[model samples]
Target: MALQLIALSPIVLISSYLPFASPSNFSYPAIFNFGDSNSDTGGLVAGIAFPLGPPNGQTFFLKPSGRFCDGRLTIDFLMDVTGMPFLNPYLDSVGAPNFQTGCNFATGGSTILPAKANSTSPFSFGIQVAQFIQFKTRVHEILAQDKKIQQFLPFEEYFGQGLYMFDIGQNDLDLAFYSKSDDQVLALIPTILAEFEIGMKELYYQGARNFWIHNTGPLGCLPRIIATFGMDQSKLDEIGCVSSHNNAAKLFNSQLHARCVSFQGQFPGANLTYVDIFSIKSNLISNYSQLGFKQSLAACCGYSGLPLNFDNRINCGETKNLNGSFVTAEACNNTAEYVNWDGNHNTEAANLYVSSQILTGKYSESPLLGDSHLLAISEI
Candidate 1:
C-alpha cells in the first residue's frame, strides 16, 4: 500500500485540498506575527542591527527589506489581503513606524528553544513573546500618557481581537537535526512543542484569542538540506528531498495539528487554525513544472550554479573567497522562475503562490477566518 501511494504523483495526494474562492466578511483589526526568517519583515535587522544587503528584496521592494526572500513574505501577503499596513517590527523605533494595527516580533534564525551562545538570533520564541508583552504594555502606557498617539499604537482591545500568527519550529528542528540522530530529533519534538505551547499560553494569558499556526514545511526539500545531506543517494526521496528530514517534519506537523486541536477547548473562545504548509509546499515542489516554475529545489540566489546552487560559505548578496578567488552569490536573472531563493527561503513569487494556497482555506484544518479583502486579493 505504501509503495502504491509513493508511486502516485503528489498532485493526486493534494487534489482533495484544492481551494475555492469564497466570499466572506471575516476580518481582524490587527495582526501579530511570531516566527523566523520565513515571516520576518525586519525584526532581526531592527533588533540586532543586522544587515541584509541588496537583491534580497529586489523583486518587490527593489532593495533589501530585511526579509530573506527576494520579495514579500507570506505574512506580507496576509497583511495586504486583510487591508492592514505592513506590520512594523516591534524593535524598529525609527522611521515613525505606525503600529496602530499590528507589530511583528519575528526574527531571522529564531527558534522555539532558548538561544545558545552561537544561535543566529538571541530572540527565541520566549524572547519574542516577551517582546510582544512589552509591546502591548508600552502601547497602552503611551496611549494613556497622550491620547494623540493612539493613531500610532494598537488599542488595548486589539490584543484580544487581532490575529496571532505563528511560523516558528522549523529552526528548532534544524537545530535538533544538527546535533542528534533522526530518532533523537523525533524524540525532541514533544519538548519543542511543549515550549511552543508555553509561549502560546503566555500570549493567551496576555489577551490573545485568535491563533493561526503554520506547521513547518518540508525541511528536507530545501536546497540547503539537499546540498548538505544529498551526497548519499539512498537518503533522498523520490522527489530528491532528504527523506529523513521530511519524515521528521511530517511527524512534527502531526503532533502540532493535534496540539492545535486541543487548544480550542483548553482556551475558551480561542479560535485556533492549524495550516498545513507541508502539503502546500511539498505539492508545489512535486509539480513545479506544471505550476510554471522552472526550478523546483534549486536556490535562485546562490553560488556554484549547480543543480542546487548552494554553498555554505557563500550567502545571497555576500562575496566569499573560494580557492583564493572572490565569488559573489548573485540572484538569478529571473527570480519568478525559481521556487527557492537563498537555499532556505522562498522567492517573492513562490511566497505569493503559497499565500494564495493558504487563503483558499482548504489546507487549513478549520475554516479560515480572514477578511473579505483577502478573498479578492487571493485571486492575484
Candidate 2:
C-alpha cells in the first residue's frame, strides 16, 4: 500500500513556520494530554479496577501501569521523540511523583460526552480539562513558594510553549454504536466535534498554543469488531474489514479536518495540527506483509477462539478452564510482526512505526518537529 498524503488545509499550510527556539537551544518545558485509553498513561489504575497486569505493559514498562496496549502508547512515543520525560497520571497516588514537567488526565473508557446517566466514572473530556485547571493552580502555588523557580511562573511561558495533545473520540463513537444504527452513529459526529471544539477553545483560553490532535482511526477493522460484525462474507471489504464502520471513520475524519480549519481561523496564532491516523493505520493493514506483520486482523495476545483469536471472556494474560483442560491467553513471540496488540490497541512495535511515520510530516496537517529538532531531541 502506497502512503498517500492528505491535502493540507490552507491555514495549516501557512502556519507551518517553526515557532519555538531551535531545538539545540531550547526544548519544550512540558507536555499536557487529554484523551481516553489511547493515551492514558496510568489514569485507569488510579481511578478504576482494570486488570492491566503482566502481558499488557511487558513490552516496555516491564509491568502493567494501566495502559491498554501491550507496550508504550502513541503518547509515550511522542514524548520520546520530543525529549520529554514520560508524564505521570494526575490521579495516581497523591505523593507518587511531581507534576512540574506535566501530567496526564486521560482515563480508559472516557468519552467526549458526559457519561451515561448511570455511569460511575466522571472522567469525561470536560472533566479532564477541569483537572488540568486544578493542575495549573497547584503548579502556580508551588512556584510561588519557591522564588528561585519562579521562572516557570507565568502561565503563558509554562503552558503556551509546551505541547498539548488530544487522542479522544474513539470511545464516543464506540458508545454510540452500542445503541444506535450506522446512520445514527454518523449523526452523532456533529455533537462529538462540538464537544471537542468546546474543549479546544477552553484550552486556548488557558494559554495552549501548540496542539496535536489525532483523528480517530478505523474502528471497524479492529479484530474484535471484525469477529463480531464480519461474519457475513459479503459484508467484508477487500481487506476483510467491515466497510460501513471504516466509512463512518472516514466521514468523521473529514468533518474533523474541516473543524480544524475553522479553529485555525478562530485562533490564528495557535498551531493546531491534525493527524490522519486513519490513513496511516489503514495502509499498514493493507500492506501488513510488506510491513512485517504476520497477523494484521487477529490479535497477538488474546484468547484463542473460533472465527478469530480474540475472546471477550478471556483478556490477554488471562486463563480459562474449558471441560477438563486450562486454556490461557498468551503473547506471541514476535509482537513486532503484528499490528493489533490485544484486538483494540496497537502493539508497541506498531506504535513505534506509526510515530516514526507521522513525525516525518507526511500525515500531519502541518509539519511536526523538523529533522534538526528531532536530531537534537534524540541526542538529549
Candidate 3:
C-alpha cells in the first residue's frame, strides 16, 4: 500500500503542474489542485496545524506556507506558466471571500487509507479533494453573477474548464513496505489499487477531465534511508541501490505501468498518461556529476541522526566542525547541483527538468479526450 501511494506522488505532481503552466495545446481556464505535499502552495492548515520554521521556505515564499520544500511547490510554477492567479491554499481566510479563480485543497502527508501511517507530509488525496469540491461549489456561486463559463479569447477559451489535478499515493506504500512484514505488504496492493482507481473515477465524476498521471519514481535511493541503514558500499554493486528496495520499487512501477495503460484504454473522457519519472529521477541522482549536480546523496534540509540515518536526517540549520570553522545542513554552494532538497523530495531545479518531460509526454491531454484527441487539447 505504501509503495503504491508513493508511486502515485508523481501523478499528483504532474497534475498540479499541468495547469501551472501554459499547456502546449492551450491554457486551462483555472487549475484546481488536490493531493499532498507534492503540489502544496500553502504550508500548513491555519488553526488546524502550526506553521513550520524558517528553513522550510528558505528559498521561495521565504516564509513557510507550511510546504515541506524550500520554495514554491508545483502550483506556483503552474500559475507562472498559465498566467492564472496562484491558487489560494484552502486555509487562507482572506482569499476565501471571493476566490473564484481557483484553490488548492492539498495538505502535507495525507493518504488514501485512513489507517495508513503518518510519514506522508500531510492530508490524504481523498480529504483534500473533498475540500476542493466545496471550494468549487463556492466558485459556482460567484460565477453565477457572470456567464456559466467565462470566455476570454483564443488563449483563455478553455479557462475554468475543470482542470483538477491530484498528487498522492507515495506515503501509503512507504509505511506498508518499509514498516510491515513481507506478506502483509503484498496483501495490501490490490486493495490500495482499487481505492486509488475509485478515487480517480470520483474526480472524473466531479468534472475533472484531461488528466495527467505520474507513475512512481525510484525509492531505493533516498538519502535518509542510506544514511540510516549504513549499508557499506562493498555490500552493493556500483549503482548504490539497495537490493531489496530496488526490487520492490521495480515491482511497484511494473504494476503501475500496466494499470495506467488499462486505465487509458477504459476511460474515454479521462486521458491517463503513465510517466516514468523514476527512471529519470534515478538517472539524475546516479549521474549527478554529469547533470552538473554537486550533491546527490545528501539532504539539504534534514538531520543526520544517531543510528539510522539511511535517509540522512540532517537538519538544515545545524552547525558542525567539518574541515575548519564549521558545517551545517548538506546545503550545496548551488541548489542546481543537488537533485534532492530534503531526503525524500527533489529541489526546484530538478523539478523543472522533470516537469519538462511530463509536459512533452505522449499522454498530453486537451480539455478532454474527445472522440478524436486533437492537438488542440492533446499536447501534454
RMSD of each: 6.0, 6.9, 7.9
lDDT of 1: 0.83
Off by over 4 Å in 1: 1-24, 367-380
Predicted candidate 1 versus true structure: per-residue lDDT over 55-125, tens digit per residue: 88997799888899988898886676566788888888889999989989999999999999999899999
| CA displacement after TM-score superposition, residue 317 of candidate 1 (Å) | 1.3
* Alpha carbon deviation, residue 74, candidate 1 (Å): 0.7
What lDDT does the true structure give each of the candidates?
A: 0.83, 0.75, 0.56
True-structure lDDT of candidate 2: 0.75
- TM-score head-to-head 1 vs 3, winner: 1
Best by TM-score: 1
Of the candidates shown, which would achieve the greatest lDDT relative to the real structure? 1
lDDT of 2 by residue, 61-95 (tens): 78886898877887786676455667888888655
TM-score of each: 0.91, 0.86, 0.74
Error of 1 at 209 (Å): 0.8
The clash numbers for all candidates, in the given order, read 0, 0, 56
Candidate 3 segments whose C-alpha is farther than 4 A from its true place:
1-24, 43-47, 94-101, 115-122, 142-160, 229-237, 303-314, 317-330, 362-380
